[model samples]
Target: MSSFAALRRAHADARFKCIFLRPTLASQRLGCPVSPFSCRLNSSTSESHVSDAPTEETPIVASEKTVPSGDDTLFHKALTPSGRRDLADRIIQDGKELHKLNVELKNLQRFARSTELLVKGSPWKVAKHWFATPFKEDVTLDNGVIRVGSQTVPNIWLRDNCQCNSCMHQETRQRLLDTFSIPEDISIKTAAEFRTAIEVTWSDGHQSTYDKDLLREAGANSEKKAVIRQGQVDIHLWNASIAESKPQLNWEPESRPHEKRVDKFIQGVLQRIRRFGFCYVNRMKATPEATEKLLRRIAFIRETHYGGFYDFTADLASKDTAYTNIALGAHTDNTYFSDPAGLQAFHLLSHTDGKGGASLLVDGFKAAEELLHSDKEAYHILATVHVHGHASGNDGISIQPYKGFPVLEHDAETGALLRVRWNPSDRAAVELPLEEVGKWYAAARKFDAILKRKENEYWEQLQPGTLLIFDNWRVLHGRSAFTGKRRICGGYINRDDWISKYKMLHFGKEDVLKNLAAG
Candidate 1:
């Protein structure tokens, strides 16, 4: 017989003995006792007594019986006395406990699964991973999808893709491409897809893959569209022509010949002014005569400082002069004037006497552009808010006016930016409702902080005879205080005169004269 079968037979024998064997000392100790009638087993041998006694017709009674056990009985023996009555009760309780534990375990597992799914499904998690990855190397593009870093973007922008040479290289002179009608059957295959890498498939059966870093460097989203026009004069030639025609001032000897050299130099300076909003004329000796001549040659000059022709002058030797102060913060000149100066000319007549007097120029336009791109809502708030500038010092000149000019304005025709107005302390209370005041303050503060950064500052020392002219409306000028003596001559040319001069030199003599008459 098999081992399992032999073990089963032994257990059965033990159960039979416990149920029907004679009452022994060991059986009583185990809490099990043999029945009295069961122990009398010689029925056939004692048949005569049984028949005579049975003939008496003794009545058989069926009554529930209990077996008694002492307090010292073992747990197993007490549980299974003779019949399976108490053992069945213990089994039912154990089965109920096991079922309750199984249910609890299932509930815990379900909760864990839900939590895992929630974290995996969050968009914030996806974005965080995308930004943290190194994105400057290569961009991955396959078929129609573009992958920037870890982000997989859809191909819906295919129609907007600009690959023409005119759009790609702005400085190049190329024929503009003719516009074509889009095909009606064009359809995108997928909205977005992400894998170990991106795959893009075009409808024309063309496929492409690009490294994610390279795609980012290509500036896919930041690329701008510009219209290319033919028959336009080259910028260099145009500048040269303007310089050749420019008038020369008499204060300083022509460092170059009046006809050939001065015209070329002036043209170069004007080009720089137009392109950068400011430019420097160097090599002229620093003197009051030279500064005055330079200012007059440009156009009529504005006298600042309460009807004073030399409204602003830097005299380092004279402590009484306003120009000797070293700690001048960034500000636009003539805040008190009814019409603020449009252009400012500063001629450093002498710099050898000063130690720390360095000129600092900031491109307010660039700062404003950064603000617009990073926080558009803030840019809008600052742009729409009205600010009042009042200057009340020395001779008591106070002028209040309202202007809707933005801190940053774009040229309507060329789309070039024109930066204007950056004076935080002079900013008047905004006309916005009380509810929006907090938001306005926050935005203005952010803009000012960006402008104050050193990265935005262009530092230079004004050498003697160096005349620096800048668009006063768009450029903010400041200086660092020095201990030594320094002298400078400052003045302004009205916006009308400057524009008239530009048009006269570029557009035509008639247009220039008409604009001058209109002004």
Candidate 2:
């Protein structure tokens, strides 16, 4: 009973003001006196109705037609309990609806200056003064969503990101609330704009005041997140022009350039690979472990059936073509993988013994771009047609058919080349419609011709004490048949792992990685 009396007083105080001060009356608009039980009298000498309420006072029983308020529902035994909830629920359902009744009451509107305008049900100073700049359209809210403009932000998302004292630690800027505690279908009770922020009182009575700048940034971040989920790779398109000024980073690994300077140099190399898809490291460590150590600088060596790392020599009778004394054609490795290795590093341990092992570099992305501009039909056909592959002499005992991909992979929405898979040696069988298979072969031929163009091919005689690393997704690698014993050591790195290392190296954090994915 005492609690109920206290709540009534709080509610009354919230809706009314002291008339002794000559303050405006909200009931004036209704042309009636405000219920003394619901409104506070304005006077320091006047006693409040709540303090006067006694436990022995006769209970004012409500009629069936009378709706129960938040405080009204609390006097169960005294006034006959009814089906109702607390104040929080009432505010969400019908209290001061912005679209109905007085828009001022619904929104955080300007205070009334004229006393004549003050009336019952008028948007008087409810609790505190609020300066709000509202949106144009009527706000729409749902479970985990608040549609503001073109974007719909998740309620749970917004609540979790609340920068309030209860939600986050001020000094650390670390979240304090448990994300899982938020209901999956949580809804917004009321939404209004402030001069610099938007105030949202949730159905659960949790209030979130987000800055306007924060909401705008959130909308942008939401769109960027969606884009990242679709395609996490960025690329640079080029042709023979890539050959004119190769994206080269000539740094000696053994020299151990000053730490800060070396870090910048490493970052530059990574940037080159990110932009041009390949980079050359001149005067690098010349050893069997050179390529392996270099991979650690970026990420762990991608361990496939090839074990960890390898030394390519003129082992004539070896099962793998790379090991034999044969000319390898222009191709990206790991066509057999669904997500192939992204970075490939080659260190010339001993190239003097070799005769014609000059590395042939061709940009598959460059070829695809050319084909796309000159022949859109060919590009589309190649991009759509899927080709199967198999790793014949892999270390794995069980021979499982590797997942396949089209010769050219493009984003359906942006028509951007996402990945390229071309390996004649690893090609398995063509499993496609008869009509489509012929078209695929023709498209592949045209793309291959572009790759084979002399202007597009950048031949570099990889010398000892030099390390060459290229993007397996963009630049195709090949080697001319060699005579003498050539010893080349290299390794493959997972695409995602390399990207992760690159992002961390350049940005020193993961938050900015999404921006790098865009062209």
Candidate of highest TM-score: 2
Measured against the true structure, the TM-scores of the candidates, in listed sequence, are 0.47, 0.62
Against the correct fold, how does model 2 do in TM-score?
Answer: 0.62
| Model 2 score (lDDT) | 0.62
- Cα lDDT tens digits, model 1, 275-316, are 456777766766666666655665778765544335244543
Instruction: Look at candidate 2 and tell me the lDDT of residue 374.
Output: 75
List, residue by residue over 1-519, the lDDT tens digit for candidate 2.
Answer: 455554454344433332221222233332112221333333332433222222336555454323223445343433422212243233233223312334334222223211212331111121111112222333334453565556677778788887788988765666898999998878788887656667888887899877654555344432233233322334455655665677777675566657677667777888788767888887676787666766677778877765678776667454678777788989988787888888998887885554887888888877876786677667666766678887767444423345557887754433345688888878887766575478678877889899999888878888887778888988898988878878878889888877766666665653343232211
Off by over 4 Å in 2: 1-149, 154-157, 160-185, 190-201, 206-218, 221-236, 240-243, 252-260, 316-318, 394-402, 513-519
